[model samples]
Target: MRVKKLLLTLLLAFAALGSVALAEEHKATPAHETAASEEAAYESKSLWKMMTSFYDTTGLKAIIEPQDGVKNGLGQDMSKFSQSWGRVIMFAIIFFLFYLAIARGFEPLLLLPIAFGGLLANIPIANMTGEHGMLGIIYNMGISNEFFPLLIFMGVGAMTDFGPLLSRPKTALLGGAAQFGIFGSLVGAAMLSQYSGFVDFSLKQCSAISIIGGADGPTSIFIASALAPELLGAIAVAAYSYMALVPVIQPPIMKALTTVEERRIVMKTARKVHKLEKLVFPLLVIMMTALVLPDAAPLIGAFALGNFAKESGVVDRLSNEMQNSLINIVTIFLGLGVGSKLAAEQFLVAETMGIMIIGLLAFAAGTAAGVLMAKLMNKFSDEPINPLIGAAGVSAVPMAARVASKVGSEARPGNILLMHAMGPNVAGVIGSAVAAGVLLSIFK
Candidate 1:
């Protein structure tokens, strides 16, 4: 009886607690309702304004009134000009690059990514080229730090066979001669700066711009980053564009420079280079670079390591990775990083026009110089040397060499100048790097 009575008391106490809790919840309901009502009222009042605000944040609005403080190459405020027209021009350029890469089969591997990155960079609100963005991150990681170009040099070395150059040391002179374009363009840029009203390139800027003549994209980027980073976009684009247009650009110059008989001149096959010589060559080159031009040691060292790996025959896996996978990956990042500089404010300048014009002339000068050098060498040589092979002296690699072979084959039915051209072609790679080192030593 006592237990039952205690239980009933406990139940009555629990019922009282429940009633109090329900009453408190009922009292809080109006506060929650009031808050929700206020939110609804605010939304109703500002719906149109919110829609308008969203519209203002859109790409169209951003392009029409690009965020203020846009500047040109001369450090003048260009916000007025940069409004919609600058972005439109950049878009046109991006699309043109796409056309070249896809439809025209230009250096698609690099050009495609670069074009896409340009598209990203020009998207105003996205700020893809800003410090915190994707392209900026990539640019800082590889390009600004000068990592990508060196890795590319390593990959190039791994892929390149110095056998042809080793077999005929004379071809190194043709490669060296091709670098005349770089120096000649330097003088041209300096002259343009002095004479042209629109262009104002400093000596450092001239140094950076002239590297476009090397026809070596990575070397150009390296030199530009070190010497005149402001001109990097124009220089890189010029370098790669000319490199891609090798077939079109070089053939005209080659044919104009050489006679049909000179093109058809059959050179004897070079003696096969021994494995020991091949192994020793990169070491010697690296040692010479270290002793003479330590500035070039980084590039030459990377190249030598790759070549050593390839020649060792023991590190075939490592060599293959450097040549194929490593290079392919770096090329994608390098392209995007380079394209990050293609923003409207950065690329669309009077200086870009100057860079383009000077770059073309530089390339022409290099080609002409190489062809002329070969002709000069041929005059003194016992064995016949095709003047057409000298055109491959621009560091465009196998493409230039292949063009030489194609032109040679056209002149004479089945003559293969591919191997012969490769000697100077590979040598041009070394020559360009050495030239970059010299520029860096002087400018940096």
Candidate 2:
């Protein structure tokens, strides 16, 4: 019986070995045949060469077909141009707009780079619009991860100086007032999301869209990327566009809100802020705002660090490096990543146009809020505050302040609203970040 059993086992082992060998030989037939199949496919190609062909490219065929039936015909899609020309046109338009903005000096600082990135993303291979392209990979790696926004904040921080706000802490109030747009715009976006069947904005999308009123690009990008990544392209474009148009958007609002006397409103010249005051103001702000609203602490922290580095007289090397080289690099990546999110399918919607509109309302509301709040503050203070500076409280930084100066000078030539407006301008930065924190916490 034992001998019989052993012979039976030996026979079974031999059978198994033959089956294995046969399987190996069969695999080799197809594995080796793939090169011929790929060569044939390549030779049959048109003017375009085989570039990063995802399927049957490495002399290998998939062992099995996709089980999901390759949703949305992504399998048959094949990264070709004919089917994706719609996307190409959108990208081309963006490129042309960017060119117009750059060469013609319309928001050239940001629009040019964004336009270039938009073009690169729509090259009709691997569909950077949806997934699995170089731009897509970069977008997921950085923007989706919130790395670009945070790093961009660091750069923005380095460029800012809180000296004006430090000189007159009261300007911080105007900054806080300017954030009225956040709440006001939230109502508008919420209304649109409720009423518009075209494209609905989620709670997160509403919050992300609301920050555009903050008039701070990195903050808008960061919040939107985290909360409403789909809206990144439109939100970013609108944010920067409005920022460039600050001089245009704000002055009209200023004129409407205040009289010539208010436009020409002069305040007591600011006293010299002590060196120690400048040194420690950033630290105190970080501590206070971090405790009060930790959601915005990252943005606030980075900005404060930059300000401290600038004022501290120490770390000159780090300061210079952060301001120029570091910021430039981050800006490039941030711009490109933002552009990658602007796929035709995602951006060419009524909601995109709506976002742009709501963004304008937000800017207008924030400006109005700042101006009215400053005018109100003027009622109580013995030392009058320039109502014009109130408009600078919208976090457009030096741009908003510069606009205040320009407008102020138009009323009374040689009037330097720049220094005065700086106070509220820096304050607006903090206020917008706080608004960002509020939105983040509620939606988080």
Candidate 3:
């Protein structure tokens, strides 16, 4: 009876401990539910915050919000305008360039790349034009250091034939006269800066802008980079835009300045240039540039090297590469590098309008000057020189030459002025390089 009582007491004690433990678990259930609910709420809030942060960083936010303190070249705060409608205007301009490139076929090679680069540059938060960005790297690599323009000059030289210029040396006079527009526009720009109440352009800026008259894109870039980097974007756009519009711009001026008889005039065929003369010409030009105008030696030297390679006949591979592959690659990068400057902050300024107007006048002036010079030369020359060929003196190369030829043919079909016009076309290239050297000597 005593042993049974002891076992019954132990069972009763164990049952009481089990009942206490069950009551404790029942009491903790509400606390566990509260903690689980708190964790789920915290996770849900975190997910919402993440989505909000992502939206804040997107391009839509960047475009919609006005950047507070963007400044223009003149040190004016342009943020209110630039960050608002300026980007939109730039996009429209880029699209216009695209349309010109794709549909109108206006210098598709450079214009297309330029438009794309401008597109990248205008993206607000992406900072594609920042120092570390792709366009920035490209701009620094070639455009900033003045490397790409020289490469472009080299390519032009490789493709150029000096035969026309050599055959009729007097055509060079037309090229020299064409450059009157450069100086004339220089004076005009200086006057505009001084007299115009709205805009202020420094003498250096004027010098850079005036080079647009030459219609040589690389030369304009080279001079602008050295003389007025601030104005490079506007000046380059004006230069190339006018160049691409050569067919459109030159013909009107040629027709306005020349008489029907002058346009109809035809000339004798050009004498073939000796290979030795071709070989000696580039070297002689390089030597003269070195001795007379060392400031131009860099551009002239690269051009001479390309021509030498071509004329030597031994470096066909090198010449071909320079003409084809090297130039094609450099042209793309050059266009992009140039386009980086077309950002709203740089291009949408008041001075850009001035550049466009002056650039157009300068181009018209150059075309008229060339036509008049040709007409004057015709009065004295034994062989009749067509005034239409003078329009090619602006150095748009074969395009300007072709325009002259086309106009001449329209006046008198069967009259081919292509080869004849190339004389001034080639001379204009040399003349523009020389002009750039002069401007650099003065301003740089």
Candidate 4:
């Protein structure tokens, strides 16, 4: 009788413990459910108001009607129409900004196309670049597997001339120096991820975000697509925005660094680059780069292929296509697809603003680093280069080079070194890609 009573008491104690645990778990579940539903409810209402207003203004009301089957991982199954409105309004704002820049004679060439692409890409309905939509399909075909960036590389190679860099190897260091911004931006992204409340960016997203400072869109896209596709929208937007803002950002630094006479410094025209040098340089570069940093194979290989096709005196048809039709077609889909990623769910947050600010700072720092390096190199070399050329070290191609040239011209009429700047311009390309590879290797 004593043993039986003892056993009964133990069973009663265990039952009480089990009941308490079950009650706690049951209580916790509802709290979570309540919070989630509240968040979903708030987001749905806010998004709905924004979309309806946008449709009312643009006569796209038909596009904003209720629909089904678009699951965004939010609480409610978000309607495609609403998401489309978000894209449309955001894209339109970007376009209007682009036009304002153009009217002000700001960076038009790049801003106009990128802004317009952002708008067209955001159109709802099929949202051609999202899932199964045609543009979305093409976008995936181009970006998912790294085709668009390489194709863009071909065009870049055709348009570039390396004579200045070959003639002046010292300028190469400036290109390398400017890449510190890329690393710095990576650190910034990591910091932001740690602090930002909504989305915690992964290591890959931080790495991809860092490439915005490279000042090369294709490189940004390539790195982002490879490591952090989620960041592609922001990275691309930030890269191009700073590229467009180069005129605004670079001028203050350039003026601060040099005296009027320094800005007016003249450079001799480069001697003719023999056909052999042009053809052999790409091959030698690829071999050396591959040996040193095999991680850079994709970008270097594409760059070399494009350069070779241009200089080989063969495959004229292939080179022409790569330069014009191929790049254009890829760019259209690439732009639209990249632009489409600017959904409100993705952008319109503190983190997005942080990325943009970090990117601009990186660009400014890169430009300063390049110019300072050039100024330092002058102490060691007999041949003097226009310090302004250092500004082109971010690899925006002739755009950056042109900005340098334009700034110099403002200081001194008849100053021209756009072609000479191309050397470091292309060098910056190689340097940025190498930096990107380093980040991927370390972080990815």
lDDT of all the models against the reference? 0.86, 0.77, 0.85, 0.73
Task: State the lDDT of candidate 1 residue by residue for 1-444, as single tens digits.
Answer: 453455456546745654664574465456556645677667643664464467567665565555677543234454655556777778777877877787778888888888888888777667777678899889999999889999999998999899999999999999989999899999999999999879999999998999998999889998898888778888888888989988988899999988898988999989989999999999999889988999998888899999999998999999999999999999999999989888887888999999999999889989999999999999999999999889889889989899999999999989999999999999999999999899989965
Model 4 per-residue lDDT tens digits across residues 205-247 = 7778878889998999999888978677788878877887787
Find the 10 residues in a row with the least total lDDT in model 3.
Answer: 70-79
The collision pairs in model 1 are none
**What is the number of backbone collisions in each predicted candidate, taken in the order shown?**
0, 0, 0, 2
**Which regions of candidate 3 are displaced past 4 Å?**
1-40, 69-78
TM-score of 2: 0.81
**TM-score, every prediction:** 0.88, 0.81, 0.88, 0.77
Q: Rank by lDDT, highest first.
A: 1, 3, 2, 4
* Lowest summed lDDT window (length 10), candidate 2: 58-67
Model 1 TM-score (2 dp): 0.88
User: TM-score: which is higher, 1 or 4?
Assistant: 1
Cα lDDT for residue 345, candidate 2: 50
Instruction: Note the residue pairs that clash in candidate 3.
Output: none
- Candidate 3 residues 151-222, lDDT tens each? 999999999999889889899998988887788899889888889856799989999999999889889999
Top candidate on lDDT is 1
Better of 2 and 3 by lDDT: 3
Model 4, residue pairs in steric clash: 128-136, 129-136
